[model samples]
Target: MNRTSFRGKGKRVEFPFREAFWMSLEQIRKRLKRSIILVGSIALGISLLTHLEMTNVILATYMSSMGSTMEAYQFWLIIVSLFVCGIGLINANLIAIYERYREIGTMKCLGAMDQHVMKLFLIESLIFGAVGGVLGFSFGTITAIASSSVQLGINALSFTPLEAILRYLAISTGLSVLLSVISTMYPALRAARLNPVEALRHNI
Candidate 1:
């Protein structure tokens, strides 16, 4: 059995999976500060929004007798926080695109396909989203407890509905991840569609 024949016998080796994976990591490493900023922004947004929404649910569903008025703040916070977070996430991804023009061009010139570029950016964003989701939920829950404590004079967290708390954590994390990916989509596509020639010429 000639090893050479077997080695050269495969269909064209396309799927730049390994390259894209490593490059995705490299992209994050190189832009560590920006990545951190993006993740933090997302986490803050998700945490605050989740905390407020969950608070509203608990109050409305369980304690409607006493805190009906407070629920208004929770509702508005959810809407405003999410909108701001969405804007920040989109801008962060777009900034990454502008910053990485040269890298993208280099990869394309080195024979990477457009889809590979797209996949790399997507992988980066997904990783960011997952990390953000976890951290955001943790912080949000803690903040909620603290705020509740203040409102209820140190007995705030003691009265929380465990089921509602768990439910909100799961939902908020999922929402954070989903929103993160959605916001990154446009910029990722734009980066993938860049003409290698023009990309190389681009200086930013």
Candidate 2:
């Protein structure tokens, strides 16, 4: 919580990321049910994505004879899954903003600016996305390995490239965070643009 004061303009307060991070955690804790739903949604989407990618990699690595038809199908499936996930996130965040109208109003009255409100929501999403992504990736990777081992023998796991697995892990996690942030943009902006008086009067 560092504050920088402008000359002759009163205090221009800036919400530090550290404070925003803790505040976001507190909000999530208070809204446990909604938070869980959002996290689960993200995890389900990411898991499906990871499962497909890992399966494809395993199949391609162990069976190079596999044709492009499967890869094309997977590409479309992944796109559809991601699109659905993004829509869910946007809907959830909009509801969250509706429910938190009074809270946002109070913060604005207390000198919190639009960016502060936006940062809080984005940070919350980032946390949820990262957690969900890691969980999904782990589950997907394990499932992929187990099924592949059964079909292709234990040697399949041993021969799978560690570098590729690590790379996808990074990709999946980053993708989740990116998607969450992007999905929240509209909701956050709406929340930010709300008039304090109107927001305070919002019945939700």
Candidate 3:
């Protein structure tokens, strides 16, 4: 009896981590597949901007090389990159809003607060962004290192290696979280407004 009571006392009431984790994973998996489709479309639009950026970069490089210009085209490329990123962010969030209604509704039904549900989704997005950002950064960095090694010795890369990696990771994660928050606002608002009876009546 003492053992049983001790065990019972040791189990504390907390957020349902296991169930929530699985549910969130499913939501993310679905979102990933959908986002990829939307992103693929957006990537095509981005490619045009990228080519324009390349042209601008080449022209700016020419100008710089000839001592005729002060700023590199790369500076302007950052602006266009942000614009493309914003569009991609909007697309990703819109898709999430459309796709995750059922999951959101289920969370609401389970006595989870609307804000908590929203946070859950937001956290999911953050995790996806972090994992993807880190992996992509690592892969790209390695590829760049390898390619440069063949052409101009590994040490020829001008960046302070650790500082560059940290800067890229920080920027990537921050931008990702910003985009995720913006993308989630609409859906989060909708989830917050759900009336329990109506939420249950409709299939998400």
Cα RMSD of all models vs. native, in order, equals: 5.4, 3.3, 8.0
For candidate 2, write residues 1-204 as lDDT tens digits: 223111223667677787788888888888999999998888888888888778778878877787413467778987899899999999999999999999888888778888888888899989988998988888888887888888898877875678878987998899988988999999999999889998888887
**Clash pairs detected, candidate 3:** none
Model with the higher lDDT, candidate 1 or 3: 1
Q: What would the TM-scores of all predictions be? A: 0.81, 0.89, 0.58
Ranking by TM-score: 2, 1, 3
Q: Name the weakest run of 10 consecutive residues (lDDT summed) in model 3.
A: 1-10
**Local accuracy of candidate 1 as per-residue lDDT tens digits, 29-128:** 8778999998898898888876675555544544566553445666687778888888888988898899888877877776656666777778887888
| Total clashing pairs for each candidate | 0, 0, 0
* Cα-based RMSD of candidate 2: 3.3
The TM-score, computed over Cα atoms with residue i paired to residue i, of candidate 1 is 0.81
Local distance difference test, each candidate: 0.74, 0.83, 0.52
**lDDT head-to-head 1 vs 2, winner:** 2
lDDT by residue for model 3 (8-88), tens:
124442344455556566665756676455434333333333333333333333345533232457557656665666666
Candidate 1 C-alpha error for residue 124, in Å: 1.2
